[model samples]
Target: MLLSAAARRRTPCPGGALLVVGDSPRVVVVGGGPGGYEAALVASQLGASVTVVERDGVGGSAVLTDVVPSKTLIATAEVMTLVDGSVELGVRFPGGAGAPTDPGLDRPGGAVTVDLGRVNERVRQLAAAQSGDVRERLRGEGVRVLSGTGRLAAPDRVVVDPADASADGPADGPADGSAGEELAADVVLVATGSYPRTLPDAEPDGERILTWKQLYRLQELPERLVVVGSGVTGAEFASAYDALGSDVVLVSSRDRVLPGEDVDAAEVIEDVFRRRGMTVLSRSRAQEVKRVGDGVVVALADGRTVEGSHCLLAVGSIPSTAGIGLEEAGVQLSESGHVEVDRVSRTSVRGVYAAGDCTGVLPLASVAAMQGRTAMRHALGDAVQPLKLRTVAANVFTAPEIATVGWSQAQIESGEAQGEVVKLPLVGNARAKMQGIHDGFVKLFCRTGSGTVIGGVVVAPRASELIFPVALAVEHRLTVDQVAQAYSVYPSLSGSLTEAARRLHKAPSVAG
Candidate 1:
């Protein structure tokens, strides 16, 4: 059993002679993603000799392929979107700004064009720089970094194989006389992360058909792009490509795009998507994608077909936990192959823990980092608190970004929570009005009894930045009145959050 924080401080380090007052435990972390590296750093700070084994470069997919690269692409798309509305804001350029009055050399060849090659090169450079930063930070903190695939040999030992070797090979074998190095550890953390899920019938050819990661490699944008799946990834890419001047068709297997997100936010975004001339095919499940003559065709479940210059599959992700010797060391995994971990990141096996997408927790990088810290604190016998995901802030990086934190409306409607909800449209916000932004809103949920702010959803330009205070309120359990009392700059989108909280606090409480 884990000791309480107070008890842990009083307890002496096991098998220690007080060399420097406490024992420095050895910690070995597998997969140098946000979760693994963050835990290594924290464990090192707590007097642990740490080692991180990574097959891929440091920062994992979050920096190298998924999060950072996608966001960079989104940033470019966002600029284009803003430029599209510049005319409405009274901004003028050569050729009379806004839409071109004439298509043929309108006002001496004045038009905006997205250079896919330059944008992709910049995205790759940024991702590489961030990965290098993570690598440098880890090494500077006295953590040993190994470029290899790591697997458990025993409860207290990890065997690392060369990156080129098959990870499924014998764990303890010195068969080829180059079986790789082994490291003994007092504790181990698994943060192998995940990979994009691809369908057998719809394989990405890295050209006309691509995954989210491969989209950045194109030299020229697709003339007409067909995006499969309308989840967060699909919606983001569809919105981005449309903004970047591509004829985008979004195929959803559900009733609407972003079906899993807040209904109102999804509706608003869908409206925006249609208004921007995107072809949204609801209840359309893509069965397969096949290459045609210089294009691709996406066959739907209902025997319909959509052809485009390119096809992108954004179904979901699968955890990278297979053939890593996890179960061999007695670690439990969910039926879906994700590590089964508790709130403190502990697995069923003693002295072993997991974090990030591999653990099937919230798939956000921020949540992964928090889980890593929690794992290290618990492992190093320091004061630690289990993670409460209710306060985690998540954002969908579409045109008008959607950000949400804390208790959702589903929780309230299901009778699991009782809260008063107040929604303030972004149209009412002075900054949004001035910017010619007419879509999106700020919705806040407050506990009915105590008026404590529970959750919130923000849908506006850069909603990711505006959702921070609501996250703070949820994390600190601040009351609606307390949140409302805070000062916000005039003519700002964030002021809407304060306004929503004020309204919630003023409303009568509803009993559960």
Candidate 2:
């Protein structure tokens, strides 16, 4: 689904030497993921003829198997959670509690059943449709789409293998008859994303033992699910499956779930998971995984074993920077195989840029998009700015999402940041009480000397939405007192934002 177009808006040339009418600089983008397509569009807009070559759909992993699909499934699971309390809310179940009146104490069939086949089908359909829409949008923008695998043969040379083109065909043959066909580009942007990392002893069978990417192939909910790794993806799947009625076991190598997240947020989720019957095995490392009869067994490094109907490995992701001509082009790779780049996404080799997961920045779609645009600007000698992690906002998509922007509580507590801290619990919120909600809080950190908002965390349903205010405050350099004075709804969950800010304003003066 990678597409590129001729320039809709052209850049003026200084001497007209490189701006010849028939020889405009041709740029080829490899990968249809966020980084590739985004840059393709921008490069086209900057007067370069652009072409995007991709092996899969336009939206890449974020759209196809990860973000869009997982979020859609989460939305469905949320509705099921809401509907399960119909009786408690005084609403009749599909079959009234005692409609027959025969056996007053009779056990009813399942209150609701999820058609996994239909649900998965819908997930795939929506994902594919969205990918197609992106392709169409690129086409409308005049970008050409090439369905193929692309590789760099040299700094200014590329080879594309059309998905259906024969290996022996002239178009499929590289200029030197190398493995890949050879094409030329004035500049190359490597945006190939990544795949879910699999353990050496535990391989994904797309069934019993699976990676996060392969879980989309499942048509039936697992009776018992065991998730390995307590990272962002692992925690998200564990929380989501628990809400969807799976007996889940989360294995963590650290002392707590989401060890890298804010401690308070991690504790809140850990407590909720235990309360909800999710077996969280902290300080446990999965040494190996194997199939035992109809179930799977995860052998822990501590000699403990967990058996479950399905096992999901979310240890991490490995960049797809291999098998390309990255090394051949003098582009440096990190020790972990990531493309080594500076803040501007430039590789060691000039005219070569890498972005997104390949660059080892936070693997968020938003960050990937930003990196891509910045790379295009820099590559084309336009305006360029380095990536700023200080204002980046990342959200872990658990039940009560944990969203953090700027500095973390641990940073302040460890004296890494000179900031005052304030926290407001949701238990006292009138709207939260009305909605029968609890177990959430708003926390803020402000610079002690200047009172300028520095960082914050929000733990709540729709925390992703609520974190925007904190992100804005940090970006605009708003002071805690100014934030406290901002108007918030009288009886809304968002009121906690103002409350936290007010507390920050009351903190005693401190020195950096």
Candidate 3:
């Protein structure tokens, strides 16, 4: 049973720039994750009375178990790697009185060791803080935040059942059985993100067998961590754990790790992993993962077995769209069970839109936020530009992180796009020499004759930050000359980006 709209208490939106003549348009946003909460903010600004129904906390999985927590853990690993490598640059500890220290670039054997317990604690604290901050922000904007399971009664009506909880994120919030609240909405936005995919034979026990989300629960680091899957998630965990002084075994079904990423970037990361003594089992598919005593054993499809203290499954993720009452509302879903949405984040049904991982567009968080914002702009009758995937910047948070923007090399090779390419190794950069860095490169693409910046890839320490300029150029169709004209700090890794662009610069034609 749903409560009447007249009986519901509407949130008093604090500051709305857009003034409404009559009754403010009611917007019911389903999911409190990045897409859902972000849309709520936008809808509120547009003078729409917004109500967000979320099963988990305000920040969603990105803040709870996924992006925020994982990245915080990786930051510790990164500091260890940097300090361990800094020994070569004449930095010595108390024991080394006068002589140059041996940089353990091959493997980490320094006195510095990470406490997984402390690291996990910090990760959890940070995530909780972020979630709380988001909740307060939504409250400040007067967007009603309901912590309960939400379902569609119709395209424009949503019912929040406090008795039912959702499987979104890694939340275990207990539901209360109360008469649910009914929302009368002129528009509805669904931003329910995806959950980590699991195999029936290798179900996560959260002990020896775990998912990426459960990694933070571990007090002591695994003696030997076995990461199954060679994709972004698998590679990242493998890299981080290895740098954290754990013997890691990476199981991959493909020939090389990061099969979906850029080829050159994949090669650099794989080399780094192998050189650091991490065992990579390529073309090995795990058939089953089960506990045998204290440790876990993984049986491969090729009749081989690998044992480890813990196993982290990173196969992929499935969109959390089931049992949400989307189809009943005439919203068409894809064969993969993802909500089918257009450029403006519209579903097949009118007045109902979908975004984020649930739409199966792209798995990046930045992409999700853009999709959510675009959806609201269209819904509120504001001038809106459709979502442009090409302008979105993506990062792989590995050691010597890989970042990409716009066109990929494969698109050029396959004749799908016409562009000029230039590859510059970071070894030549002054910053690389000073920092004792020897691997990674910067690759840039541009229009053939016009020299317009089309795309770029950066591989280095914190490449995520370095790729933004390239993203800016690609989005605005800036020329190679324009990119080169922008000043980059000398003796810095970013200089390589402009240098790559400068290589593609063409001088003005003079009368012969």
Candidate 4:
């Protein structure tokens, strides 16, 4: 049966090409995060009128609160770590004529103190600038930007409530009207994103107890910091603060930190954390957190307590799907409250789609953007390939970062995948030797029959950047031999990746 133009817009396109529609469809995207904004852009490019309703600033948590702020803080910590290692490279900070000289680089008498106030100011400034940039870019793309809270009034309509006195007023509709405006959209994309999950007993006061968002408010550095939950966020902060000279403790309910990551990578990070004076409390869970006098205490489930100047809860995140009229609008949500989305980012309801952390998909910013683009392409009568998770690359941004792409070692061990594993230690790489880095490796997985690169893990400084080639290889189905034959800079960290692929190509195949 031939479908109407409107019906065709709601239908998913099979091929990866834009479907030229007779009429421009109206697209409404809620939330200004990477997922929301990217979807808006794609919809606009596909000849649809797009409006983005953003409650917070543009760029969402990944840019304004979570990813950008944390990574900036880590950059400062990395500088300190590099300075501490300068003595090994024959670099010397000479003492004053009458001052006593330090014997080792690690024990430099010149004490370095972090100016938390300055660091936080810079972080906020950077976040704000980036948010502004995103907003400007959206405007440049002819996407109508609405600064308000948007909720589904119906499958084809969105009601936007004006933001409070804090924001720059409503971006559309009457400025003085009490009743908000309602927009009729042919397609609605929900990308409201997620918020940091906190326990009822461990509420963040923003002073003593902090969420990742509130950490920037501190004027003074924490003398002792305790991080709850050993996930990516917790591990990153713990590692950064420790490097910044804080006495840090990381509490984990799992047997090890980053339990969901590559096992070898997680083990190496835990070892590095402990070796650098961090207290790793494995198999420990925080039952409650309370302010005691001038300090904070985290009571464990086993009747033990850990005290620190401040406590940070990194337990996890909850999708921001509540009170948004999603369920009432016939959008299916998972048991955990995340929007249930298919490969092409469609919701259960026609013309309604979801993306980002709100969909319970991979919580990375890159994944969020891809899902958003996919949702737009599918909803705006454009052809789109379904999202493929096998090629997604994720990184833990701790010092000497851990990055992994595609199939994991656990998959092979569980007989879920058939592959051969090959590893190359960074210590053997000339660049690593020159940089005095000894504790990292690159591991690659290849198919048994065709030597196709399936997955890989990289552990080293800037592993995030080093994993890109491997990610591309997996996404394009490039074979191990092809990767090995690719040219790489001599004496560079990437050589280790090529070397691992070369070894995988030469290794004998094992049956699944």
Top TM-score model: 3
Task: Locate the minimum summed-lDDT window of 10 residues in model 1.
Answer: 168-177
Model 4 C-alpha lDDT per residue in residues 100-157, reported as the tens digit of each score: 2332125333455689899888888888888878888888998888777888988878
| Cα lDDT of model 3 by residue, 1-512, tens digit | 43355554443222211223367878888888888888999999988889888877777788888999989999999997887676677676654333333344733335577889999889888887888888888889988888777899998688887634433234533223233788778789999898889878998988889888788888898999999998999999998998888999999999999999899999999998898789999999999999989999999999999999999999999998988899999999999999998898989887788989999999988888888988988887776788999989999999989999999998988888899999999989999999988889999999878898989999999999999999999999999999999999998999998899889988788999
- 2 or 3: which has the higher TM-score? 3
- lDDT by candidate, in order shown: 0.84, 0.79, 0.85, 0.84
Q: What would the TM-scores of all predictions be?
A: 0.90, 0.88, 0.92, 0.91
Badly placed stretches (over 4 Å) of model 1 are 1-23, 96-110, 164-179, 507-512
How would the candidate models be sorted by TM-score, starting from the highest? 3, 4, 1, 2
In model 3, which regions exceed 4 Å deviation? 1-21, 94-104, 163-179, 508-512
Please give the TM-score that candidate 4 achieves against the real structure.
0.91
Please tell me which predicted candidate would have the highest lDDT against the true structure: 3
What tens-digit string does per-residue lDDT give for candidate 2 at 1-512? 22133632344433211232445567778887888889988888877777777766677777788788888888776665555433444445665453323221121234666776687778888887878777777777777767677878888777876554321101211111223556667668889888889889998887899887777778889999999999999999898887777889999999999988999999999987787678999899999999988899999999999999999999999998888788988989989899987887778876778888988888998888888888877777677778888999999988788999998878988999999888888889998777656578989999988999999999988899999999999999999899989999989888999988887776666999
Candidate 2 residues lying further than 4 Å off, grouped into runs, are 1-23, 84-110, 162-181, 506-512
Question: Please, what are the lDDT tens digits per residue for candidate 1 over residues 413-457?
Answer: 888999888888887888988887888999999898899989999
| TM-score of candidate 1 relative to the true fold | 0.90
